[model samples]
Target: MKKKIKLTVWMITISLLIAAVLFVLQQHSFSMTEQKIEIDTPQGQLTGTLVLPESYSGTVGLVVFVHGDGPVNDTYDDGYKPLWEKLASAGYASLSLNKPGIGGSSGNWLEQSMEDRAQETIYAINWAKALPMIDAQAIGLWGASQAGWVIPKIVKKVPDLAFSILVSPAIQWISQGQYNTRQEMILEGFSEKEIKKREDYNAQILLLLKEQASYESYLRIAQSDDLISKEKWGFFSKNYQSDASEDLKNFTTPVHLVLGGQDINVDVEETERIYREKIPKNLLSVFYLPDADHSMLSKKNASSPLRTYLTAVFFPRHIVVEQYLDDLVHFVSQF
Candidate 1:
C-alpha cells in the first residue's frame, strides 16, 4: 500500500510538470497561418512570407513589411517578431519578404539598385493582393530605414495604396550621411570648427556625386588630406537619392511619420523641415517622441554613446512597439 501511494504521487507530479510546460509553449506560440509564395520581379524571383491571423474568417487587409538596406533575415522569428505578432493579433495579416540574395531568396543584392528593389516590392504587393484571404483593396505598406526610399517608389507605381508608415526614413541619403557624420563628431566631443570642417568636406563629396564623378575619383577625393575628418565616406556617395518630398507630391495615400528625437543617423531637423515644407498637410501624420533615439528607446541622454550603440543594435526601439502598433490599428480602422 505504501509503494502504491508513492508511485501515484510521482505520477501526478510528472503530469503537472508536463502540463505546465505545454501551457507555457502554447502561450509563446501564437496561432498564425503562414504561406510561402514566390514573387517574380524584373530583377529576379523573390520569396515572401505571408502570415494570417488565427481567428481571421473573412478577407482582411494585409500589411507588407519592407526591410531596410541590411540583409533581410527571419523577421518573423527575429527583430520584427513582436510587431508581426501584434499585427496578427489585431486581425491584420502581415507579410515580410527576404530582400533579394538574403534568406532563401535569390539574386545579387549588391547589384540591385533602388529601382530594382522597388520593383521587387511591387511584385510582392501584387502577389499579396492575389491571396483569397487578403482584402486586395485594404493593403498598406510599412517601411523602415532604406525601405523608406523603396516605399515611395512603389507607391508612385501603384498610386492607390491604402496608406504607408515610414519609421526613421532617410529623406536624402547624402544629407542623412552628412548629418550622421556631424552627430558622431558632436558625440565624440569635437570642437565647433572641427565639426564645420567635416560638414564642408561632406558637402563637397555630395557635389562630386551629383556630378557623376568616377568611383575611383570620389574615393581619391574622400581620402584626400584636405578632408579634415577621419570619417570614411564611400557608400554614402554611392547610394541613390531622390527628392522624396517632391515624389510625395503625387502620393494621395496617408502617411504616418514616426521619428526618434535623438536619432543621429537621420537628421530629425531635416525630416521636420521636409515634413513641414514639402509633405502635403492633409496626408501627413507626425509623431516625435522625446528621449527616443533612432531605435525609439528611451535614452539617458541624446548624446550617450551607449544609448546610440543600443539603438543601432535594436533598430525601431521595442519600448514603443505597443504604441506604434496601437497607432497603426487606429489608423487602419479609420479608413
Candidate 2:
C-alpha cells in the first residue's frame, strides 16, 4: 500500500511538471522573430527591436512605434510583444525604440519638444526605409497618448507614409490636462469641493508655466509634498501650448483613430470631434472600444490591482482588451 501511494504521488508530480512546461512554452512561443537593432540619429543611437514574421519572405510592411509618455523601453516591458506578434501574423513587421535615458539610450527625453520627437521619428523612418527587408512604401506610424502631438508633426513632414494609428491621443495639452484631472478625481470619488480645489491648484500651475517661472518660483506657490521635478517642470513648460488641430489638417495619409470609452486620461469625445473636423472623412477611420481604458486594458482588469497583477502574470498577452488586438490586426491586414 505504501509503495502504491508513493507511485501515485510521483506520477502526479510528473504531470504537473509537464503542465508547467507547456504553460511556459505557450507564453513565450510567438509566430514572430525579434532581433536587437541600433539606429544612429543626430540626437544619439537609438536602441530598439525589429520584430518580423517568422515565415515572411522578402520585404514586408513596417510599423514604427512612438512611445506615449514616461521612460519606456523598446517593448514597453513586453507589453508590446502581443501586438507585435499579431502584426507579424498579418505580414507586417514592427520597430520600437527605447525612449532616450531609458534602456541605455543616450540623451534625455524630457529635454525634447513635440517637434524634437517628431524629428526623431522621421530619422527612424528614414533608417527603416533603407533596410532591405522593409517595404518603405508600406511604412506607417503607431503612436499613443502623448504621441498624438508627435504624429501629426511627422505626417506633415513625411508625406509618403502609408498610415498612422493614433491611440487615445489628446487634442490640446492644457484642455487635456484639465479633463484628465476632473475625470480622474470624479472616478476616485472626490467630492465637488475637493475637485474644485484641485482644479484651482492646477490653474495656478498652468499660469506659472505660461509665465515661464523658474523651479524656485514654482516651489513658492505649489507648496505641496507631491512636487514636480525640475525636469518635469522643464518638459511641461516647453510643451504646455501644444495643439494638434493645425497639424491634423496636414495629414495626407489614411489614419486610424482609436478611442476608449473608459479613458479618463484624454477626452475621447473632443478628440473624435476634432479629428472628424480636421481630417477628411475619406482618410479617417475610428475604432471605439467602449469597454477598454486608456491603455486598452479591459475595464475590469484595470480597476483592480490584484486582478491586473494576476492577469499580467498568467496571461500577459491578454492583458489588453482582446477586441483591441483583433481590431489592430484587422486594420493592419487591410494594408
Candidate 3:
C-alpha cells in the first residue's frame, strides 16, 4: 500500500509538470512562414524576405517594412522584426529587404539619394502586389527612424500607398542635431554658457540643412574644432533634410506619428508643434508617451537606483517598443 501511494504521487507530479510546460509553450506559440525573393530595383536585384502569418486567409493586407540605418536581415536584429511578427500575428503579411548592398541584395546604398531609396520601396511594393495571397490595394509602408524620411518620398512617388506609419522619424534633421548636441552637453556636465554656444552652432547647421544647402556648405559651417565630426554632419545632410515641413504638408495619405517625449535624439516638442500646427488634423495620429526615453522604455523615479544604472548604460526610459506597437495596431486596424 505504501509503494502504491508513492507511485501515484510521482505520476501526478510528472503530469502537472508536463501540463505547465505545455501551457507555457502555448503562450509563446505563433505561426509564421518566411521566404526569400529577389526584387528588381533600379540599381540592381535586391534580396528580401516575405513573411506570412500562419493560417493566413487569401489576399490579406501586406506591410512593407523599411529599416533604419542598418543592414537589413531576415530576422529581428534589424529591430523591426519583432513588430513584423506582431503584424503577422495580427493577420498581415510583412516584407523586409536588405538595403542595396547588404544581405543577398546587389548595388551600393551609400551612393543612393532619397529619390533612389524611394524608388526601391516602390519596387518592393510592386513585388508585393504580384503575390497572389497579398491584397495589393491594402499594402502599406512602415518606416522607422531614417526610414521616416524615405516613406514620404516613396508615398509621393507611388501615390497609391494605403497608409504610412513612422516611428521616431527625424522630420527636421537640423533640429534633431541641435537637440542631440544639447543632450550630450548636459550629460557631460558642460556649463550653460558652453552649452548655449553649442546650441547656436547647431541652429546654424539646422538652417543650412533646411535650405537643402550643398553638403560642402554644411561641412564648412560644421568645421569648428569643438563641433561634431564632418563625417557625421555629411551623413546627416545626405540622408535627411532640415526643412521637411513643406514636404509633409503635401502628404495626403493617413500618417501615424509615434514619438518618445524623453527622446534625446530629436526635438519632440518642436516636432509636435509642427505636426499640430502645420499638418492637417484629419490626416495625423500622434501619441506622446511621457517619461519615456528615446527607445520608449518607462523610466523609474530620478533618484531610483535602477534609473541611475539605466542612465549609466544609456538606455532610454521610454516604453517605445510595446507602446508603439499597440498604437500601430490600433491605427492600422482602422484602415
Task: Give one digit per residue, the lDDT tens place, for model 2 in 1-335.
Answer: 99999999999999999998798678867779999988888778988899999987888999999999898999998889999999998999999998888887778999999999999889889989999999999999999999999999998889999999999999999999999999999989999999999999989999899889999999998857779999999999999999999899989989999999999999999999999999999999999999999999999998998998877766888899999989988888877
Q: Which is superior by TM-score, 2 or 3?
A: 2
Per-residue lDDT over 105-131 for candidate 1, one digit per residue giving the tens place of the 0 to 100 score: 887566566777778778888888888
Which residue pairs of candidate 1 clash?
Answer: 295-317
lDDT of each: 0.72, 0.92, 0.71
- Highest-scoring model, TM-score: 2
lDDT of 3 by residue, 1-335 (tens): 99999999999999999987786455434457778888876568988888888777677888888766655564434345456667876778888888877787887666566667778888889878988999878888887766766787787777777888777777665557667888877977999999998677767877787687776787677645756445555556676553556667656778888888667777777777776676688888888777666555555533255764544333221213457667777777776
Per-prediction TM-score to the true structure, in the order listed: 0.77, 0.95, 0.74
Pairwise TM-score winner, candidates 1 and 2: 2
**Which has the higher lDDT value, candidate number 2 or candidate number 3?**
2
lDDT of 2: 0.92
TM-score between model 1 and native? 0.77
Model 1 is weakest, by summed lDDT over 10 consecutive residues, at 228-237
